[model samples]
Target: MKQVTPFLMFEGKAEEAMTFYCETIPDSSVLDVTRYGSGEGGPEGTVKLARVSISGLEVMVYNSPVHHAFTFTPSVSLYVDCSTEAELNGIVEALAKDGKFLMPLDNYGFSRRFAWLNDRFGVSWQINLA
Candidate 1:
């Protein structure tokens, strides 16, 4: 009720994902991080919790101690509004590496250029040029 933010659950790749995202996106960075220590629920040095600002959007990242059968799905995705075509192209290329694309980059009628894909971390993203 107070506030709402997107939460990303990763098996053990939370830190990697955060770093990748911060590096790939402009004006993005890791705001804070809490790592697991000895005797903690998760593996030592792993990301117990992390807050990252991706292109001005604050998101929560966690390394879940328990593994599940499910993972990130295309139904829910991080939508990006790009300022330039070059930015869109760069982001799409970086995210699409070792990942699957649900919608390839093109003028999809709704936008000048757009692309929907799951990053290597399995997180879905929709990049658009407005």
Candidate 2:
């Protein structure tokens, strides 16, 4: 069977992002981190590969050896189905520290509450209460 997982690529903040996610999100964990050794072109000890689980969903995280021309955009976002208002609000506060919200958490005829924002790592997230 074929398996698919969401992959997150970072210029150099993969490790930090992975750690942050694990801390900020409930039931999240970071595991199997492999660092780049010297002369691998990436900064030594940077995250070359890692697996992160957020709310039991797998995510492949890695630091790029080369700088990309572009970063993440709001076009593609990770949608989270929060079970409670507290969960949704907690995630919103944690991710909003260094980020800006595209749409503040509010009822927009779609759901009771929703928030769209790009995190500090430039990754977009859409959290909702359902």
Candidate 3:
């Protein structure tokens, strides 16, 4: 295979999520974005497709035109290996705002500082201090 990338489907929050992730993570940015125009499948001005680079990983985000009963689950998640405690804390706090934590920031045997949470947009994430 040439490459594999993680895909995130958002009903209408793709752009917002991309912005939040890029701002929260150090050395991250939005690489590209395709917005839906008039007559497009998704609502006008909504994200048709977007590529966000978080640290170094490229993640794909899309705004789905059709509503679905399902959404992001904790079974799968974006994992982050933080190099500093400050970075870890900042990320955890930003992601946890208006979100629920599956495992709060604490030592979990494997890592000294670890946090697992579903962000406000329903995307799951695991933050760890390396």
Candidate 4:
């Protein structure tokens, strides 16, 4: 297991988001899924949380009805290092669909190809080809 895991809070969309994530990543699987109504400690009749694993990376997603209290920020982002330009471009293009592009794909000083964008779910990602 990894030492540190990313926990994402969703607004009544934990199941949907987790399903989408699992489908997007190759060989990804849902390790465990516990619904609120099924658990004694969780809120009644709601999806409290879910655990999804993608390529051995564990991610937790929880449905928190309180949306106003928290907002997704660019301060934290996932950076994917690609070995080839084609791989980087594919990731960038896929993530950019129905998403906001912070910087168009271009060459940077450190990398031959780079791009930053926030996916449809509001999670930001930085794709770079070294």
Write model 3 residue lDDT over 30-119, tens digit each, in one string. Answer: 999999999988888888999999999999999999999999899999999999999999999999999999999999999999999999
TM-score of 4: 0.79
lDDT of 4 by residue, 1-130 (tens): 6388899888777777778767654567888877776445546776687788865778888888665676577788877777777767777877888889887898777776889888888888888886
Q: If ranked by lDDT, best first, what sequence of candidates would result? A: 1, 3, 2, 4
lDDT accuracy of residue 120 in candidate 3: 100
Q: Candidate 3, after superposition: displacement of residue 9 in Å?
A: 0.3
* Residue lDDT tens for model 2, 1-130: 6789989999889988998989878899986898999999888888899999987989999899898899999999989999999989999999999998999989989897999999989999999999
TM-score, cand. 3 vs. native:
0.97
Question: Model 3 clash pairs?
Answer: none
Residues 25-104, model 1: lDDT tens digits: 99999999999999998999889999999999999999999989999999999999999999999999999999999999
Stretches of candidate 2 off by over 4 Å are none
Stretches of candidate 1 above 4 Å error?
none
Measured on C-alpha atoms, candidate 4 has an lDDT of 0.77
**Worst ten-residue run, lDDT, model 2?**
23-32
